[model samples]
Target: MSTVHIVGAGIAGLAAATWLLAAGRRVAIHESAGHAGGRCRSFFDETLDRTIDNGNHLLLSGNVAMMDYLRRIGAEDQLTGPSRAAFPFVDLSDGSRWTVEPNAGPIPWWILLSGRRIPGTSVFDHFSALNLATANADATVVEAVGGEGPLFRRFWEPLAVAVLNTPAETGAATLLWRVVRETFGRGATACLPLIAREGLSQTFIEPALTYLEANGAKIAFNRRLRAIEREGDAVTALDFGDVDVSLDSTDSIILAVPPAAATSLLPGIEAPLESHAIVNAHFRLEGAPAAVIGGMPFLGLVGGVAQWLFVRGDIVSITVSAADALAEESTERIAELTWADVAVALDLPASPIPPCRVVKERRATFAQTPAAEMRRPGPRSPLGNLFLAGDWTNTGLPATIEGAIRSGEAAACAVAT
Candidate 1:
């Protein structure tokens, strides 16, 4: 059997390896980094004396690809969140708090309920998002939603920025619409929030690596592909820094690196160039406050620097999506601003900030604009045996875990034939 060479052992590469391995194809994974889980891993923070994920990755029940991937690796139960589709939010502008809870059915009558909707939003305002579904290529979330009114400030704006990781003014409306169609449109059963109970590596990355290795797949760490040599319409060889690997006609190669790395390997690739940052402030606290609701442990915020706050035991983590400007600020300033939001949302006193670890993922995700989204290429390249896989690829979705997994599966399907 011809071995399938998978490059860049991130989630995309790992996912592709698993799919091919299940189909009885010989597999070999080569990673440039010394360790696995490129961006979605946990590390022990000495400052906080705890293990913290590099960034916050919240999953919804409607994320079918991620759920299927988790189940395949036998780690589906590793994630946990609130039992119901509930997202509690606080408006720092007016000191108003409310929980947006979706009902069991598709008809969103919950928005008509006073307490279930955003503080000042009406049912018509919630349903106004229907414009997003038919948004054209040039339409952004702002254009679709009008970028004003009570719903925009309280609900659409926050949800758009959080899920798209790009400002609503520039974020593609279709992408956000797809997310809403899958999650919110499907009702509460599909919109329940979820996150790794232990850590991301324990839930998503480590298990996939283990499953691939236990299935007799070969994995090589610290093996970076310096160049890929193509002859005519086929990729002939891959050159590592110290070693060169020649590919047989039957053998296939999957390049699952990031867009920047992939551009260097394959010349003139159509990949998303613009990227945004995601900033996280992980703070160590003594214990949970008395205001904790059913131990849900996370909250959404409006008119604040911190977009979302997540709590796990004694650690409280704050997430700011599309935070390119904030990422450039000093750590102390970021902590100070984030803690202010956390304090108000969690109902804690405005005490001095605790020991904090600020993490800035500069190239966390691609800027999901219509122009950038159009630049995303499919898995197949000019070289028949060489396939491309990444969240940045044309997966008909934003650069998300679900898109990454789907891209890998698409690459596997290409090589499987």
Candidate 2:
């Protein structure tokens, strides 16, 4: 009969509620936004006359936690990916194209095969990734992988930026290496590139809401957590602008909001404050862009303002991670520059940029620098009945869907015990 008052309706909160509700525990979700998914949701853009996600997100097959969450919501079939682990990349500066395909087994003998590896990279260069795996707390991606090399420029740097949302020169190496260990280290089976087949909301959010409601979980939108009243090491009440909900001794609370909101609500709590921005440009294309092997919907880009391209029907969306510099540019200018890269990568004409919608997620994620990584707090707080869950928590991984899901599960487990 214990009810859990969950704050926020993002993936973290939804994941937490889903787990608790499935256990026959009473659960309620409160969100400030009118809709769910926080930064991972999609909306209809009139300019493009199509639905587009606020940001482009991808998941590897190794994301076991997220896969399990999707299975719980009966959305396991809503994601699409390539049959194998292959990353097709194009260098706009020289028009050279290549796909880094890892072998089935873990040893990665594919590095010795010219046809399987990136051009100008040798086995010795491939082995340099070991530094990343063993990087210490103070080490950076550039420090672990070295500064100037074909492999570093073509592979490690982009992966670091995309995963960490921090510049390679200073991004924490441990995060990148953790990603490598979980996905690429497992084998080709675990590294298959996966993304939402329709949109992030449809695949990750809406279905979760549906499942939660069907299981007797109540969700309240626009009921933001204004404050938390504490009475001697326990959350006594939650203030939601117009009303305050008092909690009994057996009731528990899950703080699933962003780090800033958590810090504001709880005293003497430290969390990652430095954040990175991401820019996504969605263009209404005349037709689908060429796919990577096995009809993968996304392509990696180098030597351009954009980093990743996602093609859905007649829509082409560009994802620019670690986009602090680019996020400051005008929306029109970002569309123009991103179109140039998309045109080259997709082999399309560069004239008359199609109707484009630019989504700039300022503070998309915490800066994954060593200093910021040290600031991440764990789920347990001083209050006995309170627990925290978010990608920004000490999940021992970068801010990703997998990390967020894992964090929620961790909090739920902690609260249960």
TM-scores, one per candidate: 0.98, 0.98
Per-residue accuracy of model 2 over 288-337 as CA lDDT, tens digit each: 66664346688889899999998888889999999999999999999999
Q: How many angstroms is residue 303 displaced in model 2 relative to the true structure, after the best TM-score fit?
A: 0.6
Candidate 1 per-residue lDDT over residues 172-218, each given as its tens digit: 99999888888989999999999999999999888998898799999
Query: What is the alpha-carbon lDDT for the whole of candidate 2?
Result: 0.90
Poorest lDDT segment (10 consecutive residues) of candidate 2:
287-296
C-alpha root-mean-square deviation, each candidate: 1.2, 1.0
- Can you give the lDDT of residue 172 in candidate 1? 96
Task: Score candidate 1 by TM-score against the native.
Answer: 0.98
Please give the lDDT score at residue 211 for candidate 2: 94
